[model samples]
Target: MRQYRHFDNVLLVVFFSHPRYDVNLDYYERTYAEYFPNMVFVGPASREDAGFNHSYDVIVDSYGSAENLTNPEFYQMAGRMAHHMLFTVMKDHPCYHGYLWAPFDTLLNVPRLQQFDQNRFWYHSPFGEYVPNSALESDQDPDLHAPPARISPDPALNLTEDWKGWGPDWCDPHVGLPACLPAFRKAPSSQHRRLASFFENGTERFLGGSSDTLYVPGIHREAFLETLALFLETECFMEIALPTTVHLVVPPSERILFVDHWWIWQPPFNATFVRMKWEEGFEVDTFHTFHWGDAAEGESWRAHPENIEDVRELLQESARRQGVRLPVATSQVTGRSPTASSLLPVDQRQA
Candidate 1:
């Protein structure tokens, strides 16, 4: 095993909505502080409003309505805006090297924070192939609104012509993907600049960019890909089209890594634990992270505190085993002092 270096990078958790059962930001602050005392969490202040601000290290803000509406282009732009913001914060700030942008509803069981190379842009899912789960009838069922599929270099479609109006002659194919687009923008406002440049550079390279190279998150933030938002817009014919479907025609040569469980209806590649299975001392190292799925049935992480504890424990244990000194627990950790009895169980105490 490789000896892990002390990570100087900051972790950023981005959430668009505050789930009903979601743990207070303070809880996350305190918990992560134990392992990554330097980590930060960024999210919207409330689910109903569109506002942006930073709390401790967590960011609270709303996705502007214009960007988050049902329109496909708006959604693609919104994702672009979020990634641009992340790049700006990480690149501009002197305190951190890289950040993690996780949806608020996710249940994390990340036992150890791996040292991801900043040279490449890494994402939980690469090609966006959403394999169907047991709940779904089949993987190719177009009617099923399954989780976003992982990006596959080789789709079942042709690669010569632009699939949905995007390719190498237009611009970098990777720029179309939401997770990979931020890496391509020159600045946080690069989207606007790129739009302007598009006028000057012409639609050839501007719209037909290639996304062949593998993007290692911290290492290559600028590599582009057709984002989920982009796909939805083009395939579903949403209100706005972002012109990111070039990847569907010309997939990357490198294999993209995806979060094991992107679609709930499909069985995960190696899922050791499912939703609400943390209390059984279930090991967290089995998977990097687990998606809680849509917010319809109140099954998200916001509704489960025990799962949060499970996530915290897994990360802490990973840190301990790695010989990293955990941060001291303080009200600053949770934004409140610990109660006597709640602190009785050392393991149960706030991170």
Candidate 2:
């Protein structure tokens, strides 16, 4: 991603490891060191190398670590747990303005890079206006993480009222969560528009949508961390839990839905517009996720991406959106033919 000049401004790049590979974090750090100097790896395995990070690890968010990888509930909620764990590692290193969470196979639209530029990352987030001066000005260059307001809560606990109290004393004000998420049941067999958890009040609706890729800032850091607990408590998948939890936390006075969802079919998108991330999307933070999961029971014709071709096609379209073609980004390092899985992510290729 550093191939693009805009990505050069990214202070730190973190790779959240899946539980299966958490045992050998140093190997990942040593192997990918050439890509970026400030890059680091976070996972359950890093627990073994305490010298590599803070003394503790994020076991709760590691999602079953190696024990419950096969458990569907634990597996689905694990994605959010990864975000929580990443937040834990990033809080100490306040050089970054915010964080972007995308799949290993994901690609940034060449044009979309401007929105995520270091100067504009906070503005493009959900609560852009809520950003504090400490995050923006740093006029005196004070310790952004260890502000005087921070109460030094026990970091050992996985779930808490405000995890690290990022909002209570750090931000402008703490706008409490919504009374409850709102949505209606769409009956069984539907992809969305249904209840995520078995609530006590029998509310059959929820704020549900796609969450494959997202960007968040310090304002909601702990709220994002508590999402896994909410998911498990609600007994729903990440899709429902994430969106509902996110919207629920937005301050009512500033709540707005920037996300866009789609129902797509076909793979390795043959045409320019097929399965596009919305032909005319939100100009500033336009983002759409192609459902990479299995087709619904009756919708057998839907294109289920089995390999990386669909992802490469997505990147090709991302380039086209900027009136350009996919560049030979890997050639700079490999010095080999650009055809050598240039678009295929290293992790997937190795897997």
Candidate 3:
């Protein structure tokens, strides 16, 4: 087993949102602090206290003075903007080698973290092969290196030179279906015809960009900004934007590793522990970032109690496998006991 040590050049960004029953501050404090303590936590003002309370190394208050309508659509856009802001912030600080947008509610499988190589870009796999063929055509076009023209002609909306070529339709079918279908259905007759006409011709223009890549922070800052700009043009979910940008810039051979088996879902009311599979080498298993209608619901395995227990056992088992002995509880020499099961490794028999 490889020993995991914190990298000072890496910046771990945690996107924390409010009105979330699933946000586990304690877990983040214990897990992230132990591994990647130098972190920047970004979240909406509604839950600013949560981040501040955790004593995070850096707490960024998203939506500080911005005033906008509070609705589902606005919320979705806000979430996307939060990610964009994080990237922009990173642009100013060039000392970091990589950046990580870790989901707030996910539990860290430490042994798995030990195996992570920061040199590669990591991202989520596609939701399934539902994108139109045309969308994929440009993926191989060498000319696509140049960012697309500005998303809008409005001077006020004009993105910086590095921020051009952002537009939409870059997600897998399953992920985009729910978002696109509703807009397609609610449109007036003219808009409906436009959407219908596009799909009838082929959704390649709409569905071709990559939405999820497991790791991406290792690219040069300029390339990262360019990739981010391309995704912004799509005005799609950042999950889709991430991989879409990577596909645009990263060579096929050097593309980031993908998290295939990891499950990211909303923890149900009954979930008592984190749910994951230790058997699978998931790059990052995320859960409960935000509960957006049906979008939040995910795989059943994410909430099963058995699987949750398995996650715990896997952590301890992995520790033992790594030749790390759990500290004996109720130590006679120091009279100290372990405080956390997920983080602190301690012998259960002597407790």
Candidate 4:
């Protein structure tokens, strides 16, 4: 007998900015709400923005408030940073299993989520575990870089001189030190000492000598949240900061799932184009569509007019078979094709 998890078993958190509000948000809201009833939306919203209708059951507008502690230096990555902080604030929710950081643009087909192992961490396969000198080679590939510059091979493990500007208290407003401090204190003292030691001394050893990104596979709630809280208090990219901190303490039992949703898209992506794909049936358990206000890269089949029509037909048929109308659009607003908007450009997509 196969068992699937219920909506209440997992809390889905979706984050986006005001700039991306109009772009297929209504579609995402309707589709996801029907798909996963227990979901929340978080973003930077002003008083003017608050009165508008949002699709999710709960909305956390973290703008123009002291709680909005997003780093300006990483403005391009603020949405992701906001996501990490959102987890911190909502970690204690009764969702017995765990939570997922769902990109606002992603259209997931999780027919088997009930079988998902809560302790298992989920990530894509593109970024493998950094194994010393061997893993760093990928950063040197010109095809991987848009401008062709060298990036730190292992941004997670290495702390180079370029990080001088990173000071403590970088994301304090968002993570809420006062709230997390009690949890931090509750964590074993040994964990605290080791994390402090690494932050102060271990960085010099793995200096990569250039600006590059880093990624972490997964993070455990109750266990590592305090250490994560400490790391959030410091100046570090969330992607790099998370796994780096986790590596220092978490054991092997807490696993990471390297998910490969799709292949890499060609470079020089005009910042808006992405490569989206759909076949026989939406079999992919999880998917991350790259950007909300974007289209497919010029040549990809996902963007091809014929393929888009085929996918629309498939979606209609699938909805019919399931005994439901296609997720009806509530609002009149429509934007780019959902298939293209879902495809994220390779380099610019979140790690």
Q: How many residue pairs clash in each candidate?
A: 72, 3, 19, 8
lDDT of 2 at 186: 17
Ranking, TM-score, top scorer first: 3, 4, 1, 2
For every candidate, C-alpha RMSD to the true structure in Å: 12.5, 16.2, 13.8, 12.2
Kindly list the per-residue Cα lDDT of model 4 for residues 269-303, writing each as its tens digit: 21122122222222233434433234447521132
lDDT of 2: 0.34
Q: In model 2, what lDDT does residue 323 have?
A: 53
Clashing pairs in 2: 22-45, 183-205, 183-206
Error of 3 at 196 (Å): 25
Cα displacement (angstroms), candidate 3, residue 258, comes to 2.2
| Deviating ranges (above 4 Å) for candidate 1 | 1-6, 17-24, 45-81, 112-120, 124-303, 313-351
Judging by lDDT against the true structure, name the best candidate: 3
Q: Write the per-residue lDDT of candidate 1 for residues 193-300, one digit (tens) a residue.
A: 433332333222223211111122443222222233333322222111222222222223333232232323344322334332333322222232343322345433
Ranking according to lDDT, highest score first: 3, 4, 2, 1
Q: Which ten residues in a row have the lowest lDDT in candidate 1?
A: 206-215
**Alpha-carbon TM-score of each model against the true structure:** 0.43, 0.41, 0.51, 0.49
Weakest 10 consecutive residues of candidate 3 by summed lDDT: 329-338
Please identify which of the two predictions, 1 or 3, would achieve the higher TM-score against the true structure: 3
